[model samples]
Target: MAEVGDDVYREDPTARRLEERVAEITGKEAALFVPSGTMGNQIALLCHTQRGDEVVVGEGAHCAYYESGAGAAWSGVQFEVAGRGGLFTAAELEAVIKAPAYYMPRTRVVALENTHNRAGGVVFPEDEVHAIAQVARAHGLAMHLDGARLWNASVATGRAVAALAAPFDTVSVCFSKGLGAPVGSALCGSAETIAAALRFRKMLGGGMRQIGVLAAAALYALDHHVERLFEDHAAAKVIAAALRDVAGAWVPAPETNLVMVDTPGIPAARFVEAAERRGVRVSAFGPHRTRICTHLDLPREEVLRVAEVLVEALREANAEASAGMGAGTSAGTVG
Candidate 1:
């Protein structure tokens, strides 16, 4: 095991190296290594906005719905939801930007997600990001990217991460989510922004002593794991196609390594349980929806196996529901 070094004082070589590499990749002036994606995002928000300010975010974004309202709880900032299903047009953003005369909370930042999770891993088109960035600039709002799956988007679109990050004031990238790193996230931004965020990070109890061991894994992933993302995306597509043909289910075309499937007639929990029984693990996001994610450790063959398990699971659930309906019909007749 690697020795723990005090990271709070900036003496951790591994953390420092990871931060530098993140800044280089994103073409930012500086970077800070954080413990998790949520912390990176919250710290970035804290750096950019005053208390009581608001951020414009997609309704389905991870920060808005998944981060447990930490932005408001920690920073006293609220969200102005932009659109449904994580899709927001530049015009929609323009309309939502707050005017100075209004007593409403000022929209200090526009936050976006790449490979939006709730949107079936949809890649927010590069042109769209640029357009939204332009809108943010026009309104003097800071732009932040919840780029947890940015590497997936970059691989799918063949766009450089730096080019994609250019329009935003800050971006948070995760190494653990899909990159196979055990733990780590990087927040990249201008020197001033990172300096400001570091203070907030310490305040939030994110200061570490020595994190080079984790940083080492992140460094390894950035160099060797990035290109392999295409394999994950391809596997997700295969899984989605397989699920689409299953009874009582519909899977959208995958844009990255996430596939969202709807079990129209079967309860989501039942579907998940069935899949788990067959040795495939997935998450139920809603009453009728499940999400499957592909990652570095998941091999292509395993992905196919998951698909097979999913198909069988759906079939089993549908059959059970049909049998129950038949039982109810017979009972009614007997009654």
Candidate 2:
């Protein structure tokens, strides 16, 4: 049985052990376990920012597009996108930094997403991260990383998780994503920052009683799942290869576990529905784009079968588009 104690009082041994393990892996002074990646990120925002401060982010960052605007509602901060794509260069970050003025919202933090979602899970290059960190340090701005899929990055690039996380003042890593833990994320940073984050986590109603059961899962994932992520990455590439020949589909070679598809002239919903009809599921990333992710549950033996179904789905969507039956409908939003 998992060890249980009052986590609200900071006595949960399993959570403490998980936090210590994550902190050691991330090379941070301390770490705090939270119920979700969203809460961990929001707590980081609250710790790094004051009300009305601005946080610069890459376009389509999870914090900006997917977090239900918690950064604004809870942290009282607004986001300024740094670049057009989901990854930006240091110069791009520099250009977005607000000039000092009493009338302008001060630029207080730069938030980055490594293995960026919605951009085909591309890893943020380590060199660019260091350059961006230098710029942030020069400007007296703090750095935060949404390293939810960092294990993927580490596996893909042959870099240690600590190396990837080193440039950031605080990093939030999720156990529920590639790691396949049922629920949990941890925010790692200096002891002072995490101490403050503990208060914000409670303020945001994230305090839990005995969460060792969840912590145990995260710990297990850290031990057994990290190295196996390469399997997911490989499967994504295989699926992407199979989908590349589908009509009207632009499938990029996946860098990690996510495969993003752009369906020109066909509604992404049409593709999604077609795939669903074939007992396969994928998300409509936008009106003309779809996102497919490979994870622990998607075994190697199933990758080709899934890819074939998705290809058929794309072909059906293409046929519908050709018949002028896929017009003026929304693909809807997916976080």
Candidate 3:
């Protein structure tokens, strides 16, 4: 059913279907499909700003730290970083706008990441989102949301994705991550902005022929894979609780799917390598931090088993998950 034609001409039926579905879900006027979340974000940036304009982003946002400098390289723009966990307040956002002067680069956009990746999957509070959106609007700036893990955010927060996305001028969401699709993301916005993004996409070689195969997979994921994200969140909390008990290790409770574990005495690389040897894998973030993401691939039983395996591995390495200085959190939320 997904046999497709050239998408550059917007002739691919399934691709159009995906775009329509995404627009409906995000409550935007239109949507465009891109090959990846990075492309979706860059395209939004490219369409929203001119050369030398500045985009405000979170301190540890993917656009700031993880996108290979594409914002500066491809968009020909600079960034003004604000806030931790990728959540900045309206005052913080408004304060960063440059004074209107010929020498100053105009602040053209404010970008946000939901279920912020590097921050232990913290969901951006709805109040903060609206407040910041108001600031962006007041400053005559566009807003772009990098909602790559928004499905997880939505499920965890008990909010509709549309509600979370409503305040932004444009929003990008991924189908490949928690949604379980092979590849693809969508950027939703006004028709004008999406039209502009499409040109940028073509300029960046993001146009495709016969992309409906992937679009079909993405559509399937929307129907089948979005509802149970809470299971992953639950699994992450379980692992975090277990990790807090490991000697010399403290883990931040996760809001969504990703867990960040801190090992003060153990090198992160050593811990990751040791865990891998025991068939338990984690992402090394720094010398002392490791990131473990729970997903559909890891079931509840597997999560508990991995926790025990991690404890055992660390015990063998003479490293236990110790109660750190701040381990007595009531919310158990650290990072």
Candidate 4:
């Protein structure tokens, strides 16, 4: 059982241990545990920005695409996408910075996502991150990292987590995602930034009593789950290799645990249904794209089985789409 106390009063021993461990791992002066990744990101925004500020982000960032406009609602900020395909270079970031004027939305922060989600889990290049940080500092801007899958990035690239996080002023990391913890994410930054964020966390209703019960799970994940993420990455590669030869299926080499399949001329829903029927569940990422992820629950043997099932499902869906196209063409010709 975890020792528990009031986190709002800053006395939760388990929560304190998790925060300290995350801070040390990320090379930050302090860390604050929050309820979800969204809240962590939102709190970072609040700490960095005043009302009516602008934040630069890469396309398809989780904070922009998946957070349901929490940045706008909670932080009073708007986003400007710096580059295409969810990863931006320093020059691309510089191009979007607003010129100094009373009439412009003052540029305040640059946020990045590692293992960019909607871009099919590509890892952000380390050198590029350092260059971007240089640009941000020159322009007096702050940096925040949506590092929800940073653990995956670390294992994929063989870089330490602190090295990857060094360029940012604030970093939000999730325990629930690849780490296999059931609940919690943490925002790590300088002691001053985290102190400011604590007030914001309370204002936003994030304060909790006895949060150490949940914090212990996150601690356990850090001890046991971080290194094993490589297994999930290997599983993703297996799936991608299996489907690469299937007709009408375009599978990219996954850099992490996320595998995205593009099924041109066949609806994503069609492929998803086909996979489900064969006992493999996948998400419809777009009209013609399906997303599959390997996680803690899916063992090596199960992943191998999934690879075979996905190949058959892709072929079945493709054939059905071609048959429907032929039927429509014949009907038009007869008429």
Model 3 per-residue lDDT tens digits across residues 79-117: 998775578888888778899999999999999999898
* Pairs of residues clashing in candidate 4: none
Maximum-TM-score candidate: 2
In model 1, which regions exceed 4 Å deviation? 1-5, 325-335
| Candidate 1 local lDDT, 151-231, one digit each (tens) | 988899999999888999999999988788888899999999999989988998988777888888899899899999999
Ranking by lDDT: 2, 4, 3, 1
Residue-level lDDT of model 4, residues 1-335, one tens digit each, is 99999999999999999999999999999999999999999999999998899999999888888888999999899999999989999999999999989899999999999988888889999999999999999999999999999999999999999999999999999999899999899999999999999999999999999999999999999999999999999999999999998988889999999999997787777777788899888887777878888899898878878999999998888888988843111110000
Instruction: Select the stronger candidate by lDDT from 1 and 4.
Output: 4
lDDT of 1 at 59: 71
How far in Å is the alpha carbon of 201 misplaced in model 1? 0.8
Candidate 3, 90: how far from true, in Å?
Answer: 1.5
Error of 2 at 292 (Å): 0.4
> Comparing candidate 1 with candidate 2, which one achieves the higher lDDT?
2
Question: What does candidate 2 score in Cα RMSD to the true structure?
Answer: 1.1
Q: Give me the runs in candidate 3 sitting further than 4 Å from their true place.
A: 317-335
Per-residue accuracy of model 2 over 224-258 as CA lDDT, tens digit each: 99999999999999999999988788988899999
Clashing pairs in 2: none
What is the Cα-based lDDT of residue 118 in candidate 3?
A: 82
| lDDT for predicted candidate 4 compared with the true structure | 0.91
lDDT of each: 0.85, 0.92, 0.85, 0.91
